[model samples]
Target: MPARARLADENVDFMSLMSEANRRRVLGKSTPVVYPAGTLLFREGDPARVILIESGLVRVFRTVPDGRQATVAFLRTREILGASLIVSDPPWVCAQIVIDSTITDLDVKTLRNVASTHIQVMTAVATQLAALVRNAHRLVALRSLGNITQRLAYDLLERACQSQLEMGRLDAMVTQEGLAASIGSSREVVSRAMKGLRAAGIIKTTPGVVRVVDPVRLSDTVRAFLRPT
Candidate 1:
């Protein structure tokens, strides 16, 4: 509708392709749902439905046959999940609430009907999918290029980017299990990587927290690993 037109008329965040009109339209057909942290929004292979993240953080992950869950990505407010519905059935991924969040289960059929007619809405959805694919590719590329220490450095730098440095120390809020899931490695491997960083005088660790001594030095170290070997 008019919201789609506004997006077409001006350049907006490329990742946010959906218009407010589309969001409202989808919400009108959705049932509001609230979940506390640790709640599972849906599981892998669950029936596909449109998910509108109204507020808060969601971790999308995959559970291996061995019951280990690997973090794929995180979604926050105003992001649309399961846009893969535009095609046949979607590629299902389980979502767990990382924080108390408000969301909605949008009627997939309504969204499809509206998006079928609105090019902008579809474009936004396509853009979101592209972003996810790009992130996955980046992960693959990083893995191809570095050792666990390098990868852990990159992850620590990423965590630092999202957090604040207090008195020359930055905290990485992740359990070894969670960190292992994020890095696609085992807890023991990640622990060794942490020890490497500690030995290098780059970081100090406590339970569920990593204190970065010098973010600049850490960034420099990560870059060294990222360079051609």
Candidate 2:
């Protein structure tokens, strides 16, 4: 099937799983907004409001005490964000715009009220939180592995698979600096790693676009790194 058709099908499947009451509650409560490529949506400790990705993407990150930043998560279409603040009394991290993206901002008060009245909405929110925790643990595990390049290759390949399955292609609008931050490496290191992947025929990059060329091999490499010793 076509990429657009696949995207639509996936979206429909997602919506079909949502309860009708939850769907009605979400409607008209979210306001669509757009951000520039480099805009900072929210900072750590800033106020929290639920956001749904209408289109494009956003990166959630946190700043280290030493002043470096680390990317914690990537939010795409149909993904809900700001749950940390919604569920917790304290803020956990910051969110930033990785690319020019559109999002629907939902009022936290409204969401809280809906969650209080709708058991399904509350359950769904809890499920999403559990998934976030798992991803966080995976990142911690990845950080303990071989080298920066290896970690980056793992992250890139995993992300590529998700993007490919969701959008029917492996196209990422990421810079070397962004990849470095995500993988706990320097830009120079990420550059060298990109070169290595290109030489190995695993990926290709030009300017702002990174494309997966050999997804099967890339997946094998990631799996090998993740294997139990």
Candidate 3:
């Protein structure tokens, strides 16, 4: 709870849609849950509970036909998870939060109660749901996008290292195998693209971490695959 307490005290703006008052109000009643690396926050078919990320990361993925799990998306600080439950049906995906992460668990009723008094909060819910839809669309679009490698790269950078990307190891909850699953390809192909990026001085990889040494060049590499070659 210290982490979340510190966050609330700082009053740093994240979740742009929610006002500071509403954010604090929600966090006030929420219970803080901490988990270590590889902790499963929720699994496919589990009931979704409203979760506010105070710090750390959560990876959303689904099991595939080949007995491999494809990493799909992630949730970070100031972001809300299980937002879709507020506006639509339940989610059927597994989520793994990053190491030593703290998340505030709040139920749907409390959220609804708060949002009822605050239309702005309700608007935030709407935006969150819409973002989920867009992510799904991008997931489907990845398969159709030619040059799966480039598509993979673009997807990796889409939100892998959000907001504060720099020339250092990317602490993203993604990997080659996960990337293959996201773009509907094999790890071999994903690895080749990773190698190409490294050769081009755009990125460097070490085990599970990827450092974006040159963001502009990396974007150019992604663009190259997007256009007809």
Candidate 4:
């Protein structure tokens, strides 16, 4: 997307709802920063700092005792970075840079003060937490699906709608390994699923891209997975 379009897509428009003083408070206290792809922003026990994404994406995950990492959720531009600090009494999970992204950091205390002064800011924070919870729930639910392909198709369709991208465009960018990790499956499983979709004429796959050809059938397959057992 164009920079202008991305900003518009991510903009929360808090200024319309917040008082000038509150807006100034946040802007004045915020510090701009950037992270290259794969940088670890914060660990599980690290002190929480309020962050707002200026551009790009980040993934939140938990490191298992065995040292395996499972993706918890992904955040994009205009989304808050340290959400665990916002909603929880303590830090919950680690956040890392999934893509080269820019962010603005603000003291959590400053954000709390702003939220205190603006009901809209408080509501925005609450809505963000609700979205996080919903994503966590959806990841858990995806685990029961028979295979990685089914889970990947569901995730792509859902995220495309969330990001307002068309299905074919979404498929063109999503990778098999990324899809596998998102659905808690192996890359081989995801690859096989892609092959199946290709054979059925539901999608076409290249080395790193999969293009959706039959959205109707894909939607039907996804719907069937959601039907009452």
Candidate 5:
């Protein structure tokens, strides 16, 4: 069996999910707050609250049974953390500020009120929630079932797909340490996987960037990471 990348639509973020007018409307009803690095915005099992990142980086993670935190995803400017909260049942994930950031809190009650008044907003939130769930399920599978190499391949492919192009290549702006954390491996292990990828003409790397020169091959590589259950 071959590994394949998920559909592009499965990668929806908040800015991508909402229209300009809809975004403005939501933001208008939200309160922006500045948070410093090391701030834990929310913790696992905590009630969900929609937080829109206006600037800086946020690391979303979940605590495993061993009490170690496993990286879930990173949220950046214009991305919404706790988007799954829009649905009745949200996953238990904690969000921490990786860099000093400004976030807009779209109070759940306020969002509900606005959503009730606007069908388009409700539709967009529903769509975003559905995609978040699908992506979450895939992430869980990759973390639990994939090997180090497969996990590394999938991480690079996912980040590349979300990044902008440079010289016809996709640059995933993440450090090896970040990759290690995201993939639940040591930095050395991730470095070895990266070396293999580079040797195979799958990627090129700089200090804090991984450029995918062959996305088709990377995509095919990721397909080998997961199988239908």
Candidate 6:
């Protein structure tokens, strides 16, 4: 299969590893919160708390020694943040809402307690953590080595594939500014990259939206960068 097709077909619902009853048991203890864009869900050094994204997007970032915030991840619906906190300390990271969001703040104490007695919950947590690690590594590679165009292509294609899974659409509801942040570049650089992708017939962009016109070609752009050169 093409790399882009595989990414879209990949099952990202890590929580589905849990039994239905166990899934309900863990989530039933959570409190849903609706946050508008730009809201900080949590900040660096805040006490650990698990949040389940029911819908919308979140940008997880941390400040570096240079006082610049480095984006760690862009989390979407059906993903869990702070799941690692069940076994470790609160990380030096902050989660901010990038879009209007509905999230469930899981009762951490309950989650920990449930995990102690439930094998399914433990399995689910393991799956989620593994996914997080894989995403973190992929992000690092793209940012460290990819040029603006390749980075933007990967970011847009990633979100587009995610949207396809979640909403049955191949559109990423992101602005150029968001793309820049995701790829650790300036908006002007991202704009140029967007134009490149557009010219290649890989994507179509409008205000606050980028629809994938040729995901295979977009994935090729990203995949080419990842290949040993």
Over 20-115, each residue of candidate 6 has an lDDT whose tens digit, in order, gives 888888887567889975577787888778888888777677866775665676676787889888767656788877567898988888888889
Model 6 misplaced regions, further than 4 Å:
1-11, 144-148, 153-192, 196-229
Per candidate, the number of residue pairs that clash is 0, 0, 0, 0, 3, 0
* lDDT: worst 10-residue window of model 6: 3-12
Which of the predicted structures, 1 or 2, would earn the higher lDDT when compared with the native?
A: 1
- Please report, in order, the local distance difference test score of every candidate based on alpha carbons: 0.67, 0.64, 0.63, 0.62, 0.69, 0.73
List model 4 lDDT by residue over 98-158, tens digit each: 4568988867777777677777667666656655565556555666743566677666554
The TM-score leader among the candidates is 6
Model 2 shows how many backbone clashes?
0
TM-score for all predictions?
0.59, 0.62, 0.59, 0.60, 0.56, 0.65
Candidate 3: worst 10 consecutive residues by lDDT?
Answer: 4-13
Candidate 4 wrongly placed segments (more than 4 Å): 1-21, 84-88, 146-192, 195-229
In order of lDDT, best first, we have: 6, 5, 1, 2, 3, 4
What lDDT, from 0 to 1, does candidate 1 have? 0.67
RMSD after CA superposition, every candidate: 9.3, 9.2, 9.8, 9.6, 9.3, 8.3
Model 3, 45-95: lDDT tens digits are: 787787877777666678766756665555556667777676677677877
Task: Return whichever of 2 and 4 wins on lDDT.
Answer: 2
Model 2 Cα lDDT, one tens digit per residue, 1-229:
6433333322222223358868768544566888865466777767766777776655666777885666566555676677655667634676665446788887777778877887777766665665555555555576666476668766775565345434656766678888888777799988988898899988889897688776546645543444334
Q: What range of 10 consecutive residues in model 2 has the weakest lDDT sum?
A: 8-17
Alpha-carbon runs more than 4 Å astray in model 5: 1-13, 19-21, 29-31, 45-47, 64-66, 87-91, 144-150, 153-191, 194-229
lDDT of 5 by residue, 1-229 (tens): 2111232233335655567887777777567899976577887777778887888766667777875655566555666766556656666887777557899888777677668888877776776665455555766787667888878877886566444312233678999999999988899999998999999998998899998776556645644543334
The residue ranges of model 2 lying beyond 4 angstroms of the native Cα positions read 1-17, 146-150, 154-193, 196-229
Give the TM-score (vs. native) of candidate 5: 0.56
